[model samples]
Target: MAESTQQKLVCSRAKAKSDTGSSVTQSSSAPKRKASTALPLDMKVRCVSSIPVGPLVYTSRRMQGMIIEWDEFGSEQYIELAELQSMRNSSPAFFENNWILIDDEEVLHFLHADKYYGSAKSIDDLYGILKKHPNHIAQLVKTLPDHLKKTLSIVAYREYTAGRIDSIGVIKAVERATGLSILSN
Candidate 1:
């Protein structure tokens, strides 16, 4: 009786194994998943500023140079934009195309080839350029530094409460709050 019971157990085990194998085979033969047409999240910024405020390389209607040292503790990067106005008096000629160079190396380029220029025409122009790349927006939203992320969340919450929680609004809010313009047309 014990022998008969052992054989029955072995037969059941074999049957179970066969059932599992068939299921595995069926799953393997199932339709494969299709790749998404959406842009990837790893898209790089047209321009990138260093953490804790290192060097700033930029091109503006007023100023164009590499600022290696500044009052990082007191002033943020956008203050550099004001420098453009002061320096613009000296540089009267408009640079139709230019590059943000650092350490004598080109970092970012600005060109005005047509109506949709390579450089931003204004704040609205910069905003418009950013609207084209959804992936870039996702990257910024996902990988913003912790402090900035908290601030972004707050901005998003405020916007949500105000019924203005939109892509452009969120981007503009972050830009206004952070004073970091990492994207260009």
Candidate 2:
């Protein structure tokens, strides 16, 4: 009797799918997954490092360690907060020099405010900083206000005309710094 009832249900489902022109199929024994909740505000962070960081998993209020998904493989990993704290306390420069920030946008904005390198008082100073730290060109441009960008563009152009800098490097740097095209071809 139960078999007959199951056959009828399956037939009905097949009929329904045929009527709707649907190709969907699911085994009755297949496990259903629950929808995952969004991460808490504290857990979300913007990674500024050239190296990737994490989508950290919060365990519990009582736990001192947090789970970090470092790779695509499901390897269980845990890092102690105390150990990280100790490292930070031992050498603050490790964090600063590496330019790793696992914090919210506001904290990053605060850090960008004349902290790593002081603000340029003149266009020459700005150009000097950009030339010295080519790796930081993008980050420096991001931090600059519109007026500074304009000033920097003028300085870059002058340096290029004076043959003090390479045309390709100057053009690329100025475009990145000022958000404007120098030469098309």
Candidate 3:
């Protein structure tokens, strides 16, 4: 009787092993998983100031600290997102003057310069305003004197005749006319 019981136990163990093996085979025949097609959340930014306050590397990767790169001395440091926010809050002017965020598509979104430039009564005042907020060039250009606007029109016409009219060229013309270094570059 004991021998018969032992044989029955062995047979049940074999049946269980076969069941597990069949499940393993089924799993092996299953389709493979597809690769991820998501974009990364990494970002790159530059300090647009004459005196860059932070690191020499201006990139931030996912799960990594943002690198702040200073242009003046070519120094760089890795800082957390919270720390970067702290720096910006602590020195708003420095942050705004230096690190204006450009979108991933390289588009610049600036605040309306009306309130800032409206107070200027003369070209000198406009120059001073631009000296403080260089990012306001586009909106402020509309508020320029009629003669200066005509000059800019002439410059734009020249560019149009040349088969290419980029905003940078117009801005350069503005700098030449106004004698203000609106762009850090």
lDDT agreement with native, every candidate: 0.38, 0.47, 0.43
Predicted candidate 3 versus true structure: per-residue lDDT over 55-165, tens digit per residue: 334444332574555554222333443444444445444333332321222112121211222233333333343343335655666565443443334444444456554
Candidate 3 lDDT: 0.43
Report how far residue 24 has shifted in candidate 1, in Å: 58
lDDT of 3 at 1: 100
Model 1, CA-based lDDT: 0.38
Candidate 2 residue-wise lDDT, 1-185, digit = tens: 99999999999999987866643433334675433333332333333221223332323333356333334111233334343334345544424443233333333333332243224433344656547545566666666555455546655666677877675765686687668765565
Each candidate's clash count: 0, 0, 9
Q: Candidate 1: which stretches are off by over 4 Å?
A: 1-138, 166-185
> Which ten residues in a row are the worst by lDDT in model 1?
101-110
Using TM-score as the measure, the top candidate is 2
Off by over 4 Å in 3: 1-69, 72-79, 99-172, 176-185
lDDT of 1 by residue, 49-129 (tens): 222234433344443454433333112233232343332333422222211211111111111112212333222333333
The numbered model that scores best in lDDT is 2
Once model 1 is optimally superposed onto the true structure by TM-score, how far is the C-alpha of residue 121 displaced, in angstroms?
Answer: 17
